[model samples]
Target: MCGIAGKTGIPVENIQPITDSLHHRGPEGSGYYADNTLQLFHTRLAIQDLSDAGAQPMQDESKRYVLIYNGEIYNHTALRNKLPEISFRSHSDTETLLHLLIRYGTDILEELNGIFAFAFYDRGEQQLILARDRFGVKPLYFRDELPNAFSFASELKTLRLLSSSPLSVRTESMLECLMLQYNLTETSGFREIERLGPGKFITIDMRSQRRQTVSWARPLYTRQYTVQTEADWIDQLDTALQQSMQRQLLSDKPVSFFLSGGVDSSLLAGLTKRLYPGRQLDAYSVKAGAAFVQEGFADDYAHAVSFAQQIQCRLHTVNAQPDLIHDLDRIIYALEELQADPACFFVSDIAARAKDAGQDVLIGGTGADDLFSGYRRHQALYYYNALDNIPAGLRKAGGALLKMLPAGKVRRLQKLLRLSLAPPNERMLQSFLWINRSEAMNLFSADLREQLTLDTIDTYCAGLLAAIPEEHDPLNQMLQLETHCFLAAHNLNYLDKIGMAHGVEIRVPYLDTELAKLSALLPPQLKMKGSETKYLLKKVASRYVPEHIIKRPKTGFGAPIRSWLQEDAAFRENLRERVMQVCSQWPEYFDRQQVERFYNDTINNRTDGAYTLFALAAIESWLRQFTAN
Candidate 1:
């Protein structure tokens, strides 16, 4: 993994500053290639081949096509078989991809697998291609506003470095991120920067100044895997996961594991042990304190110990209670663009530990929840169906009773309530968004609210849902949106940016192209059977993990938003200070009296604005660090 930057139709005095700024991502090597047509800068991390031959801004033997790539290509060796005609010097995947594009052109993206973001330039054709992996496991951002000028980078910070002027926040995107935990569209936090959607590739004709974007891949419900049986589904998932683990472990260095001891993380470490029983793997986890357990988080240290003992792997634990708020500023700045996920801190902490332990790569489990219908939103679909069958009066009575239930079940039922009130297109937000539309819009000043169109948000989501035909299952349709909006935009983006921030590369086995395809084919009934979420996954986990781990109540892998706001005195003070600061800075865009009122209401438990408060504080910090007048 590395950082990349390039520009077209603009004159540059130097690419040194841009390359230097991204040194954290790729501290090993740096290079640049420029001409009248294009300028490309690359900082390399040297994952595959440690020799000079692995250096990027690499070109074909003929030198007609040049490439600067980030990410590992697991199938590069296999792909090289197809390009036997080229006399190659380096064994690096970068060389493999360069030759593949030379032979097959842009049409090869659909067949390409692995997590990557890259720029491939064809000097002879005067065309440039910028592409991201199928699920956007790797991120790419570009600026195409200027008539004949174009720039692209691996992160938003590098794009800012290339800008001729200070960047302003994209108002709609900023508010959307605050309302939802992450941005739903390609629009970045800044007006001039735009995120490239997952599974997408854009071709730019440097000569004509015309660009065309195409979705070469997407979460497909092709029903291509025709295996049909409870046992068949279990076997298929088990086999695909093992195969994915094998491909993801392809690296020149030893790869470690991130073990929460939940079934997902345990299964990954468990399978790694199964794959190579003779070798012991290194696994890292957060030891959330008793104080954290009071906030309703899992005391994952015991579980981590259990799984490590079960697998005979070396476990390294990081104490979470001490550095929780201490790491906030560094993590917020590392995230660059604002993402309110508390997992960012946890993962960055894990990455730092992984780096110190001499491991350059860490295997993560992120996509299984979205792919296997493992969230409260998925559980809500079952409730939605049950509510649909009940009479209106009965449903109303049941809704009233749900309030009396225990706290844990109430959390799941709350999602059911959110879906019940929303339109079908917006139902996917049950898990993604923290506030309702009216509340979110009300948080904005009237002038800004008037400029924002509510229809566009639903329309974009409805379009993603439309990808799966109407005749298909409703849960699959919602899962498609969850993958595109939540998984791609939120989960995968942070994993890449924050992991790279510490010089640690995260490889997610579940997001492997073949494994994702297998998941797309598994029927919804297997994914969530009745109130159970990830039913098939648990069954697959049983073959490799302990029963205690498989059956644990799902404590999510995110920060405890409610408790952090209500119980933690230090964190609460930090939040209030930042919120007040932003209110003062953008008084024209936000009503200070209203925001303060909502925040106070949230702390007193009179309102559900903990998430909103946390996001606003995150935005305040990001604005202070990344934005300029």
Candidate 2:
């Protein structure tokens, strides 16, 4: 609910622009506090308290600590009961967090539960502590310079504004982005800025200019229920989700829900309706034009509308027209990178329209898929279990053979074969094998590739493996990796940038801390029963939504990029020319012939190269806009 930026060794005048760049994140008010050694700036969204007391940078009663915090502390009341000795100055949760940290030291992170990214300056200790939530619901970026200089902010752009270095692409991260369409911890398209990993707490000493990072929040995955049945699992999930939703609904301003007519969003909408029947909540969904190209699936606008009507909430359907695509450049600029797919453009538009309507909070069902195994690829586990009888060599050979078939069929077969051969905990990572390391290398210029270390992929994968327990079941290990790495680094990163771009707050109930811990305790079979994914979620959802709604095939909230590339001559031409122009400048890294082949296939409708092409287009635009200058 706020934007914060600061630096050591920088004048207050130099740091003001850094904070100004994030004005959209906090438009209600702004403040700055600085001395010769440090400067801290805050932009207030004014969600918790409209009074002056809620204003930040707020300090402790003794003024020993000053803080700039983003996110809500849902359990502040509970925490206050434990520390009755501390005099409460404001009703705002921000003050509670500052006092909690003062009382409990860094242990405050483990005691309270909420989505947040905050910086606390201990004037007494002469240190700056930066922390992000366990699930990474909020974004925090920092740049460290040797020997006592550091800068931190809510967005990379803020840090970019203050950094002395030029904006250059991190080739290893770019390669990872091109290959997997995502990057691991602390890496970004920009080499100069790094993201703080989820569950990480770091302290920077102002005196020595040194920093130390330690894990403050840990996911406890011990299976505690020896006698828990499927029915018990459903009941627990239902209760947790209901409680999370109720708590997240606390807002001084109006709250809305993004309805996709799927089980996840539909269930959220149904719950909100049941909780506050008197308040007609706003439900928003996208209504794409009839002429819009269909990628692999048809549009589900009608289903969303039907469900909205069923819930009796006020529905607002924003139409997606050709003109919307024209605004992609602006959206990409706001996001600071083009790595996000076309789906982001649609979601950004939704947030923009919601902001214009004066709505501040938007509840989304983003974590439901990752948490409940809602993806079609989750079926690979069952297929792999059945194929356990096959030899590893045969499965590898079969997988290579299947890659020659039609892309869609080949993708499914490859997933099954990989699952069969890979360790169970690794199947989730393997499922994301859209582009391989070789493909990534081929896409970049030789000079860029040489600038990057060869061990980047190994280092990233090894970090993931290190997080899993040696005795953990393969499926459980895979889930843990997905939650920590993929969900934390990529999915949540995307949501934070897009949602904050329009000053709209997004709350994910499925990722509620206690709920996630409870689900982690349930057996994996309860999560994915046989070929069915999210079996327990579906069972719990049955209580609120109809059978038909829960039974519908998964319809991803994404754009029809394949059809767009084939049919929209202007978009295709502009995208191809831009990519070629960008790559031409770095001839040593990319093969022009290979780039042309992808462009030709996409433009000529030879294949569904939209996903790959989109990734390339985003990278090209980002390079041209941020680096080429």
Candidate 3:
């Protein structure tokens, strides 16, 4: 992994500052290529090839094409074999990509299988092509409307260098950030920037300064599902898992795994050990302190220890009782996007510790949940599918009758009822949104309400919903939404940001293009057999992971957000004071009275609103960081 930044129609001096800002992403090497039309920069991390030949902003032999790229190409060696006539200079994917573009031009995206965001300049055509990987795993942000220029970078912070004016916050982005814990649209929190969607490439003509998007891949829901025998499918899955692990382990430095004790990370750790039996394997696991542990929110330290012992891998455990007040500023600033997912802080902590320990490449199992049904919410959706067969009136009556039950159970039933009654496209949106429109209005002040339209929320949700492939089964549509929106835009974005912030590179084996394609073809039933989520993956994992580990319920990367808010008095007061301070600083985006009510109600246990408060605190932190100036 690396950082790439540049601008078209800008001076070389102007582009160097943004390039310098990304030193954390690539500390080993840096290079630049500038001319009248384009100023390109690349900071190299040097994972694949440790030699100076691996240096980027590298040009082809003809000197007609220059590439400033970020990410790894797992299948570059295979790609090089296809073109034997061209003599390669080094053992680097960068060279392979440079040669591929020389031979096939833009069509090379179809053959490449890796996480990437690259800017390829064609000196011959005087055109620039910008592209991201199939899943948006590697971020690429662009500020297109600069003064007589357009600039792009691997980070939103770097892109901010293109403008001298104060950043204008987008109200819709803030609303989405508070509602969904991440921005929903292509637009970032800043109005001046936009991101390239996954599986997309754009070609910009230097002469005309006109750009046109070229689509290379579509969501998995659009593909036709194929039925196959369970045995045959499991066999294929085992092979794919092995190949993916083998490819992702192609690093010059020691690679470490985040063993979460869940099937996903555990299975990946086991596979890595098996693939390279001669090499010593290192793994890091996070353990929440006793004070942070709660009934439904506990750490996987015990399981992680057991798995590491079984695999005989070196394990490093980090105590995850974070000092949130002290770390909050840096975490929010590093993320660049508000993530209600407190797991992001844990990820940042782990990466920073691992980097301190001298590990460079980190492997994770992040994409499997979205590609295969692994969340409890998926089970709820399955139950809803069954509930749909019942009469609508009967379902309504059943939901109403449950109101006499405990508040928690009643809330769960109400959610089921609401999702069951929603239109097909809206069901997933309602299922995942942290707060509904009515609740949002109730939380916001009348002045704030007047400035922003409630309909904007509906429009954003509806747009994403409409993009789901309705032709496929409902489960597949949900998978598409999860993968494209939740997984890519939220999880993957934070994963990259948090890891790179500590100068550690994280590689996701599950998101291997070949493996994802094969997994996407599996029928929904196979992915979630009855109540068993990731059914097929677990079955294949059983061969490598321990039986007990394979059978354990998915507890995710748990964070004790609620306990910290309700149980820890000092932390609660610190958080409340911090939120109020931010509100006091930027009153335009918040109502002081309503914001206090939200915070007090959440921390005092008056409402089941800890997650909502967590979202609000994140938004406050973001406001303080980005808009305080």
Candidate 4:
């Protein structure tokens, strides 16, 4: 894994400063390749080959083709085995990609099973090809409007350093950041740059400054629902997951795992020990402390210790308790974009501890929930599908009846009733959105509300749903939507950014292209199996993970945000003061009174929303850190 920054037109005289900004991503080695046409800057972490032989901006003997890349190519050895005639200089994926691009051109991207973002320059052709991996596990941000230049980098802030333009916020992006807690679209928080879409490549003509963008791959949600027996399907899934695990383990440094006390991470840890026998493994598990237990989180650390004992792996426990007040700003700044996931602090802590322990590569179970059926939202889909069979009038009546009832202890039921009656597309949007339209409009200033239409949210939600192959099945549509949109935009973005901040390469074996393809063909029934989420995956996991671990209720990498805001007076007052003070300064986007009301509602249990406040407060941190330039 590494950090790459480059420009296709006039060479920036001082690319080193912009390059230095990404030093945290790759601290081991640094290099640059410059010419009349372009400049490429690279900071290397040296995952595959720790020698200078693996240093990049690597080129072949002819020096005709140069590359500055980030991310790991798991199948590089297999790709190299195919190019027998070309004797290689060093054992590195960088070299392998160079030769492959020479032999097969951009066509080689289809066959590469890795998470990466790269800039491959063809000096002879005077073109720079920038590409991101299939699911965008690695981020590539670029700006085309720069003066006589097209710049790209691993993080948006790196590109900001390359130009003199002020990083003003885009109104739509602000809405996205606050509502969704991250920018879900390709357009970033800043109007000046855009994130390269997953499975996409942009080729720039150095001479004319012309650029052509093409999408090379998209996840095809076939929803084939193949007629295979349950037992046979289980065996196939095991083989596929095991194969991916083997491929992702290709690294020179020691590999570790994150046992997040969830089914996904637990199963991956089990597979790691079972498939790679005789290899001692280290697993990092987060133990939510007693305070968290009091605030409703389970003692998952105990679960992790029990499972690790059975698997004979060393377990290292990290406190899930984070100093939300101080850590939030630091994490949001490190993220380079606005994100409100409290898990970022936890991820950062684990990465620092693991890196200190001589572990460079950490295996995580990120894509399991997106690929297979998991999450309460998926359960909601199950109920929605059953409701679809009933008469529309009855559904409307049910929703109306629930609305008439007071906001009593049956609040959860009220949400389900309203959710069940929503139109198909609205249902999908409701499942993901932080607040309803009325509430969102109340928070925004009048002019801001007029400029931004709620329809944009509807369109984005509908766009993902429209891509579903099995349109009739709500569960299948949601599963595919999560796989294509939410998984990369939200989950993987935070994981990659936060993990790389501590120079740790976080690998997701479940997101292996091959494994994801298999997941697409799975019958929706098998994925959710009546009320049980990830039923088929759980069956396959039974071989490696204990039955007790598999049966545990679903939980995530979480802190008790609601409780923290309600019970801890000092912390609550601190955050409330911070957000109110920030909002008072930014009246163009927010109604200060409404923002205060929102906070009061959440703190008093009138609304279940800690994330909404976090997202708003993160805006101040991000603006202060990123927009000063």
Candidate 5:
């Protein structure tokens, strides 16, 4: 709920500018700690204590340790009760963390449950320790130079301001942005900054300037189940989800839910309605313009309205229009880099409207799909698991042959073949794979291709695979991978950026550490029964939502980018010029003629490469914006 920035071995004057860039993140208060070798600044949003006592970079009573922390510790009250001997200066979680670190050292992270990105400067130890939440819900980016200095912040833009070096394009990162629509790891479109991976901790030694990165918590895919019945699993999920919701609802400001007509949002709204009846909860949904160019891609706000009506809550529908263009530049600026994805635009608009209405805390059902096997990819996983019976050699041969077709045709054939040959887990992974070696190579310059490899992607996927116990069931392994990797990295990161960009705090009940741990122990059959995705979730949701709503098909929060690029000449022209200019110097990597064909087809309503094209344009825009600045 705040922005933190600092520099080690840098002048205080140099660090101040970086901190100033993040004022929007913490408009309530700002503070800085400076010495000859280090300067730390914190922008406080003042969620928990709303007092001067909660101001950070707060020091321990002994004044030996100072900390800049961003996030909430839900169990602060419980932790406080256990340590009555410690006098708390404020009712903020920041003080609670300061006390815990003093008492337990860095090990205090394991005892807490919440999303966070924090830097604890141990003046006593002459070391700085940076840690992110177990789920990566909050972001922390840092740029390091060996033997002397480093800068860390909540967003890359703040870190960019601290960097004195010229910004260069990281070719691999650029390709990732263009082809995958997002970078796979910490490497941003800019070569100078890197994100701190989730569940990771980095320690820096001021004297040596050496840094070491390690994971304090990793996903442990344990399948030790004692519950024997589906009903038992449902009961456990219900209890966990409700408790999680109650904990996340602990905010002084009015809380609202981002109600998409989907099952995830509907279920959250239903739960909130039941928990606080007659509270007049505010529910927000995006309804696209009726005559908008991409009318067919509009969200079904009727479903969202009906659910809100059923709960007797006030529903606010925001119509997305072309005139919203003025907000696009600001949104891109806030994002620090243009995403070019229309979804970013929509979410930003929603958050802006919600913030304008004076609502601070926003709740969304972001982690449900990853937790309960709710995506089409999960269904593909079930099919793949059934196909494990097929001969490996034959399956490989068939797969290779299928790849000869056009990318779309090849994808369909491969999916069909995977359904007939692999396990559900493998299918899920394949379904979510954004960039292949060939695609990456095609998108990246030769020099960049030589320097970069898909090793990070492989290692990330491998870590998930290794987490599964050898004896665990296949379905459980798939769920474990989705929860640990896909949910933590992709879905959670998306929600965090979009929500925080508008100063809205979004909490995911499904990703509650305790709830996820407990749910992991449920029998796989209960999670996915036959072809039904999120079987257990539906059963638990039945208690809150109507049966009809519970049975509705899953529709994701995506924009009609395909239709927009295909028919909107102005949008297409902007996208095409950006893409062409950025990639013009490296013709070997990208076929300009093919790119033109792709854009023309898209604009003429002949192709759905809109997402891909938009991603490319985003990377181009990011390159131009960051480098020029």
Candidate 6:
């Protein structure tokens, strides 16, 4: 809900631009606090207490500890109950967190349930502590190159404003971005910046200049199967989701809904209407316009209208047929990190419309799919695993038939077959990668490919794969990989950037603390029963949503980028021109001949390189904008 920046062993004036750059994130007010060794800057959004008392860079009554915090502490009131002996001045959650930290120290992170990225400067110990939420719903970026100097910010752009010299482009991360659609590790696209992983915290002692990082949380994936029946599991899911929604509705302002007509968003719409009958919530959905709507894509606007009518809530639609060439520059600038996701433009359109309608808080459904196994790929993998049980001759015959099918399903079956053959650790990672290792190598220029041979790309992912707990269910391991890599790296990161870019705060109730714990306990079989993805979720959603809506196919909330590339001449021309420009600028890194060949192949539908083409376009724009002379 806010932007926070701080540095140790640096003057306060040096970090002011970071605060100034993030004014959009917190336009209500701004504050600064600095001592000899520590300085902190805060831009306030004023979600909870719309008063001066809510202003951040706030301190407790004793003034021994100053805090600059972003995001809401939904259980702050409950936590305050445990600290009855403490005196307080304001009702702001910032003050509540300060008291909790003061009383319980870092252990309070485990006791609290909220999304946040905050910096607490302990004036008593002359130390600085930076922490992010358990799920990384909030982002935190930091740099630690200079001796005895440490800086942290809520966004990469803000962190860039604090740099002392030109930032080195991390080509390794750029390669990862092009291959995977997001960074693999904490390494940012820049060499000097690093993202703090979710559920982790870092502490720096100004006196000794010692720094240490530690994990404060790990999701509970026990696979205990506590419930007795499907009905019982449905009830537990309902209770968990409703409780999470109740807590997420803690803001003083009116929160609106993002209705994609998908079950996740539709469920949110129904629950909000049913729970807060008098609040008059408004739901917003983006429509792919006449020229942009791809074949077989859902008529989300129509479905959104029907559902809104069914729930009796107001509906708003944003007709999103954006000029990809016109918006590409701005979109890349906002993303900072190069992500090939053209879906960002659609989300940005929705956020802008919500802001224009005077809605500051928007609720979304992002984590449900990852948590409950709601992807066709998940179903395919489940059946593919069963292929291991078939006799060798039958499995070989099945593979031969899969190869003879048309390319789309053929490629899917091939991937599943390969995944079934891969080691357990590598299977999930392979499922999420956009391209295979050989294809990535083919796309890179000869010089870049040579360098890649020296430094293998999978090295970073290997470390993460080895880190998965041995006791976790295989499906739970897959969920963890998707949550950490896809959700955190790609989905959540863009949601934060695009939403904050429009001054709208997006809250995901399905990712609530209690709900996460509940999800961790359910058996994988219940998560995706036989061929049904999100089976339990569908059952729970059936209570509030119509059976038809709950049973609809998952046409995710996205524009048809593949169709656009193939059908829209102007968009394709724009993409080609941009890629060529980047190739011209960095001939050493990108082979112009290979790039043009890829473009032509994709345009003629000879190769399914739409995703790679999109990623290249994004990277080209980002480099031109950020690395300009």
Residues 1-629 of candidate 6: C-alpha lDDT, one tens digit per residue: 99888777656565557777889899888999888887788898878988898888888877999899999899898889999998777889999998888788899998779889999878888778899888888889999856777788888887777665678777777677767887753677787889999889998988888889988986556446575788888998998888899999998887899888888999977987788887787878887765444534566677788888888888888887777678888888877787878678888988888889888999999999989998766786677668777765666666667765543325566677766766666676677776677665666678887775523345655555456555366677777777777888788888888888887899999888889888988888889888888989999888888877887777755556667777778877787888888788887677788778877876765555677777887888888887774
lDDT per model vs. reference: 0.81, 0.75, 0.81, 0.82, 0.71, 0.80
Instruction: Write one digit per residue (lDDT tens) for candidate 2, span 453-492.
Output: 6567556766766665452554555566667666776677
Per-candidate TM-score against the hidden true structure: 0.95, 0.93, 0.95, 0.95, 0.89, 0.94
Query: Which residue pairs overlap in candidate 2's backbone?
Result: 148-209, 425-474, 444-589, 444-590, 445-588, 445-589, 445-590, 446-588, 446-589
**Number of colliding residue pairs in each model:** 0, 9, 0, 0, 7, 0
Scored by Cα lDDT, where does model 3 land?
Answer: 0.81
Lowest lDDT block of 10, candidate 5: 289-298
* Predicted candidate 5 versus true structure: per-residue lDDT over 1-629, tens digit per residue: 89998888756565456657777777777888876667888988777888899999999867878999999988788888767898777889999988887777668787688888988888877888899987788888888865587988888888877765666666666555544455654556666778887788999887788899988875545667666677777777888887888888877688888887777888888987788786788988888654332334445587788888899878888876643233445555666643545666667777778889988778888778776778766676566656676787888899777766544324545756745654444454556554444654555555556777665655666666775546357666666666555565455555667677777777887778888777677677777788798898999889988777777766656665555555566766676776686578555456666667666654554433556676666655565566665
Q: Residue 443 of model 1: what lDDT?
A: 70
- In model 2, the number of clashes is 9
- For candidate 3, write residues 121-201 as lDDT tens digits: 999899999999999999988876644578888988887775545668877776776677787636688877888888889
Q: In candidate 1, which residue ranges exceed 4 Å CA deviation?
A: 223-227, 322-326, 393-415, 421-423
TM-score of 6: 0.94
The number of the candidate with the highest lDDT is 4
RMSD of each: 2.2, 2.6, 2.3, 2.1, 3.6, 2.4
lDDT of 1 at 465: 65
Worst 10 residues of 2 by lDDT: 289-298
Q: What lDDT tens digits, residue by residue, belong to model 4 across residues 1-629?
A: 99999876656777668768889899998999989888889999999888998999999888999988898888999898879999988888888988998888789998999999999999998888999998889999999864467888998878887754566677786777667777764777787788998889998888788888998886457556677999999999999999999999999999999986667888888887888779898999888877666655677888889888888889998977688878877788778777777888888999999999989889998888888978888888778778778887887787667655543324556666678778776777778766567776777888898888667666766776665645567677887667656787888888898988999999999989899888878888899988899999999989888887799887766677777787789888878877886677778888899999988888766666577788778887777677655
Q: Could you tell which candidate, 1 or 3, scores higher by TM-score?
A: 1
Better of 4 and 6 by TM-score: 4
Candidate 6, residue 355: CA error in Å?
A: 1.2
Residue pairs with backbone atoms closer than 3 Å in model 6 (clashes)? none
